[model samples]
Target: MISAKLLRVLAPKIARRYSSECAKDGFTVTVIGAAGGVGQPLSLLLKLNPAISELRLHDLVDVPGVTADLSHVETSCKMVFFTGTDHSEAICGADVVVVPAGVPRKPGMSRSDLFTTNAQVVYDFAVVMAKTNPGAIAIIITNPVNSVVPVVCEVLQKAGKLDPRKILGCSTLDSVRANVFLGEATNTDPKNAYVPVVGGHSGPTIIPLWSRSNPKLCLTNKKLASLTKRVQEAGTQVVKAKEGKGSATLSTAYAASRLTYCVLRAMKGETNIVESCYVASDIYPGLKYLATPLLLGKNGVEKNLGLGTINDEEKKLFCGAVEELQKDIKTGEEFVKSKNVK
Candidate 1:
């Protein structure tokens, strides 16, 4: 029985009230493999997230100190530690689960080389997540992501809990590298450049579509090819630079954090949140899944925005990527099947 003029005045205030109330309900995020290079920094970054109410760190070892270290950070989010088999507690009721567990990639070792070991690790986490928190959005950061993501999907599907939209492979590192390198090339801020990196995560499969870069650049064919190659081999460059000490960790944590924030923002009902991630998609034929630009929303990937326009060079790269990616994906699916994981 409110008057029309009064209703309009109160509507904005009511909406603001609900938003503020929702903010209090914050999210709980769990990090599996929370002690490693990427996990430690990633956990610290998540600690800074205002919308996160709880940050759970789980690792086979070293979690107690890692949790204690992160607890000192001034943040509203409550920190929880889970070690050994008790890591199950971390997954319980988690809103988002990030898996970065597995052995670090040694120099001369490719993501695929880590696959045999990482697949089992990723599978174990997936099984627990599917059973306990099937509703949680899973971000798989374990390498050989092109394969690990599929393995996770298959596990969830077998458990009758598969929600493709809720599963994402963290390929944001590739996108981050592309943005930084391209920004450097153009004298633009990396934050301002939007480069859509599609295909897969490993060498030869990682395709950066310069034709679709926002704040686009004009470059010769030679320069474009060089930049694209740099994006694809950036990981290897880091591995070599580390003198076999470590792979890319700091930059990776930053990229993973960026992706996590994108997902969190979308969960908050933000509109038009687009990120490039490796997920199950129908964007290309023959390939069951690939990394493409996705418009994220409350339930996860709201829509799959396929590769826009690729130049001749990109098209050629895409063709080669499809061939290699298909094999990599098959390797993952086969790994799960071989384990009698149906």
Candidate 2:
């Protein structure tokens, strides 16, 4: 009884309403390497989220204990533990798979140094996820993320299921650090401050675009350089303060959890969701990947926001960062190629 003209206009709105209703039911999220420092806290935070109806924790060891610990928390979400060789079991129905596995960086060790060991660890896990949860979003938070992410992409590609949009490097920590440091410099509330940190996650390669800071505060070249250095070395600062016990586990866990939540909210088709992450892209033309502001939606990275603008001094830093990042990207790609040959 509906006219063709009216049907065309109303059909899209009706479909959108249906999709929104379906998203309210939430999705299953799996945390691989869920027993580590970052993983435990990240899981606890996710369990507290009403948007997650099911949570699965997987690790090579101690998952039962971690599961037991989290299961006690009174929440409607069902929690499951899968340990040892059952990694795939955890990922079976995952809407998102978060990886915070691999060894933590020791004092005097660079992120690149963690590459050899973490690459193998990440690749092994990526293989399982690619097979079991091929469509699920993969969030890589392992140390040396600049490389481990590439390893993940390569493994998924080999499995014939590479979707760049679904694979994201959790560079939110870098963004978090920039926000705090900028907040301190400008005497503003860190909670409300938003700073865009682009490029890779390690030293020299990390770039905090202060020019794009919201509620723009004028900063001199000297002050800007000092702030930039502080943001880049914030991780090392945490390591030194911890005095060789472990690297920035607690803060990193907090930052990773925030990112996981952002992805979950976006997948629920929540409007106006935006966050920055290191993702596979041609955004910078010659670069293999770059961390830039990302618009999140049901499909993960919906759009790669271009770098706004940079002053002369910032431009110089950007070029230097791109140069160093090239080495990191090459190292990751080469490691995967070498392993596949063997």
Q: Which candidate number has the best TM-score?
A: 1
TM-score of each: 0.92, 0.91
Model 2: residues >4 Å from true position, as ranges? 1-24
Error (Å) of candidate 1 at residue 119 is 0.5
Score residue 95 of candidate 1 by CA lDDT: 91
- Write candidate 2's Cα lDDT for 80-174 as tens digits: 98888658888877899899998888888866678878988888887887888879998899979888888888878888988999999999998
Give the least accurate 10-residue stretch of model 1, judged by summed lDDT.
13-22
lDDT of 1 at 259: 84
Clashing pairs in 2: none
How much RMSD separates candidate 1 from the native structure? 8.4
